[model samples]
Target: MIDKILNTRTILAVDDDPTNIHAVAGYLQPHGAKLLVANSGEKALEVLAQNIPDLIILDINMPGQSGIEVCRKIKQDTRLEQVPVLFLTGSVKDVSEAFAVGGVDYIVKPVRSEELLARVSTHIRLSQLVKSLDKANLLLESVNESLEMKVQERTLELVTVNKNLRIEIDERRRLQDKISYLSNYDFVTRMFNRNSMEQELKVVMETQSDADARSFLYYIDLDQFKIINDTCGHVAGDELLRQIAELLRGGFEFASICARMGGDEFAVLSQSLNLDDAIKRAHLIKDNIENHRFEWNEEVFKHSISMAVVEIDEGIDSVSHLLSIAERTCFESKRKGGGEVSIYNYSKDYIDKTQQQMKIIPLIHQAIEDNQFILYFQHICANNDSKLQKIEVLLRLQDESGKIKPPGHFIPVAERFHLITEIDKWVLKNTFKAISSLPENIIVSINLSGEFIIKSNAVELIRDLLLQHKVQPSRICFEITETSAISNIGATHRFMLELNETGCLFSLDDFGTGTSSYEYLKQLPVDFVKIDGMFVRDIENDEISRKMVESISGIARAKQIKVIAECVESEAALNIINNMGVDYYQGFVAHKPEPLMNLFTLVK
Candidate 1:
């Protein structure tokens, strides 16, 4: 840092004495200082015009101009004012005048080399320090101004970037919130959807045991909903549903989860309520809906709802099972009439009520042990003669109070628990014995469960029974529903083939109700195809139903197989079937189901 400031400095030696100039030049020449010799004041001024030196050594006894005059002239110019001057004097006579004109110090006599170099070096270093300080002050002011400008420009850019960043954060938060709402909430009713409700129930089931407070599920359906939609329009129907959703939301406390289960159906999962309280809540909702009047397009209409409440307890295996009970119970309410509330019952509290599968399992075991099972026979009459063609033996169970329950009441439980095969064995044994003495032309049909057909040694069992009772195999027809047969088609075909070799007949019951579209008939050895009752029951009034029945009958005839129309409850239905070329009919219109013993007397 020091070498840059005080490096290779020049010194001006102004003197009229030639010898003095030579001595001064020779003294500084050996050192690193550049020496300029000026013989007079005028000469020094000429030298100063072309170049500026670091320091000046002026002899007081000069010839042309006095040393003091020369120093004064040098100090007059502003550019040369800061240069340090050292006087070469014969005495201390003119040194004061030299100091007055910016003379820093003076040397006497010939100017010894040691004294001359020391004074020249000191003044050069001092002069350099002053010039560097002045340059720095000027540069500092310029840099400060530039720094202020940069800070202003950069600060503005940062503000803009920060604003945009905040906007992006807010937009992302809004998008995330919208996605969350759509996932968990139904857009139509602004309530929890089925997915959220199922998850909540699953959490409760998985995390808890039998809760001290009983939870209940209410399954609700609007009564005669189609009437409103057809007469008023779907717009009016949607508005009515919205109003009812709000009503349901307000009726229950915040504890319950209310949801719309699509269309005109809704459900509520109560947090905790006993059976009585749950029933009352369901009735309250039913009454509220029944009394609420909806005004649309200046026309006012009233509506009612049917509801079913099932307690959500540990007895239920899963959410689907609990919902199944609720659906059946609600359907039972509609079956009787709308504008009613029904509670799911376990035992004989309901003579023909919705039964829980778990509660009925033990009852089925008990029934099997105590011989509480019975057989009821419904007559299947031939079409052209309208005479008795056969009798279908229906399985029934007697409860503790002797009320007969149909297959719909307990068959699902029996099938699920693998007890259906046992029930089938009982039916086959009793049926074979009851008709042992009957005429050979009287064919008796017995329904077999899919589980029994797929897993049991059915062909050998039936063969043994046929030989034991001496009842002709041709008179005994085994009935398997289309849905059950489709589940195990190969097994069903094998069982039928083995039994067919023995002269026993196979009939596919409930045809046209499964996933198969008449393609399975050619695959199996079926003697008769019973058109599903769903189509036959509505054939008198519905064209679609009539078309379905007609097509099925045509296909059966094409295969050279007879078609049986089930659920022919009215003469209208029978007349329709007769026109369609149906061979036989089985329904209450022909004859109500009679006991197996009673049927024996009729045939005898």
Candidate 2:
């Protein structure tokens, strides 16, 4: 008698031999279980295709396909590999061989009913244990989610109460005829609360009516305030904000209103000022913010500030619109860097262009869904002979109206919205597709934004593209700006090496511009250097500019890397660079970046 009482469990029995299958099925049938039979390995696979069972009883030495082959196939499949396999073999040798192919256990037949039932029951019980573990893991995740939601609810209640207390304090000060001296002002250094400042701006805009009189609103945000907050704690963050507020108020005393807009942001409203005067005040405020040193617990901390100034004119229709324009202008300033100020001018095309871009963002998103963007290749040539060594794939957006818009008009907007990643993916797919049609040994390079490089999965997307296209990785190159490479060295280095491992190359573009370090040139995984257009444009006439290019070209040669002189227009600039041993060149003299169709005609 079997020691264990059999519980009902479904079992799938697979074999080509009908007598052997019947014998195994009959043994399991009496043990309070249902048996499913498949006549061959192919039929067993088909059974699994439709439904999964708790355990499989397989027979070895069947026709059409061996049990070992079926067992191996089952183990190889990710979905079926977890199901326990019990082999039905005629001999001990066959059972040993079956175990080699990932079978769990075996029963030798002409079968003893008791032994077969015992082994089947044990394997089924093991499979049940695994399913139980999975359910427990799911339950643990649900409990964690419930606890997180409760914590978030408590946090919101605290913030709401804090805001109410602040409003009451402001009201009490107003009753005491110390409305401007309210507790909303940080007494330690005299900066207003974010809530108070916003309220003040609303009052000023409502009270003033002269449209021609320019009212300047400056939004100031300190750079890297979080670093000080983390390093020196909330006390230090509070102290820094207080000190910054004092410096701003002192510097802009002539302004109509100076108020702290919470955290590290401050707002200044200057009334009845000309464009030049407003700009002068904006610069002075910026300089003061940069020069001011904050002392926290006896340690001096220095940081920069970014400012966005908007001059209220007749065109400004609403107070919200005025504030929104200032905020967006400030955002643009922050993107460029935090040490300067950007004044919102009504005449600037970027503002209207940005508004139009916002309107088209939804349309652009739809284009991505409908596969409307197309990739075009513009060749980057050898400057000396004008021979094409590589092509740079450029993206063009085709709208519903069948209009092709150049990247220059839309790429900046794409970068601003962080939508460049999707555009980058589309470029990689279409570029690789284009490569298959091009001649072998010709390299294709793609230009990527610093934002895309720093924030997205550029490497993974490119790797998948190369694999799908079956293109040689060596034929692909990625170009990044010199400024971007130096900005985040660690992240850029990791990305470069990851792609380099797959035989792709990297180029440090627009070299000799910005605050790029020459020391970084040797440290970076750079293959080609593209000289900035500024140097090339003036090199023909300016001795100083020509000398700079010569020096940069010499450095590139010493490192055994190629250099491409960009924007070379005149014969003299070309003659100078070729003599300096520049590896390649690009300019109007060689070729301008044209449409891919034009490039085909020009090259032919």
The regions of model 1 sitting more than 4 angstroms off are: 1-355, 385-388
Best by TM-score: 2
lDDT of 1 by residue, 148-170 (tens): 57557788676665565566556
* TM-score, every prediction: 0.43, 0.52
Model 2 steric clash pairs: none
Task: Give the per-residue lDDT digits (tens) of candidate 2, residues 1-604.
Answer: 3224344566789976566777886777776666778988999988888767778988875655668888999999888888989887754334434755678667665666655765677667656655654564455456556545755777767666556545544554444444345336644457665445656766766676766666678888787786786677656777777777777778765546777654466788776458888888788878877777777778887888878878766577766576667766766677787786887874246666667877876666776778788776655666456434787777788888899988876777776655676677667677788676655557888887775576445677788888888888888889888887888888888888988999998888889985655787888888988888888897878888888788888898889878888788878888888887887777677665655555445444
**What lDDT, from 0 to 1, does candidate 2 have?**
0.72
Best by lDDT: 1
lDDT of each: 0.78, 0.72
* Model 2 CA deviation exceeding 4 Å by range: 1-224, 235-262, 266-314, 328-373, 381-389, 397-407, 412-422, 514-518, 533-555, 565-604
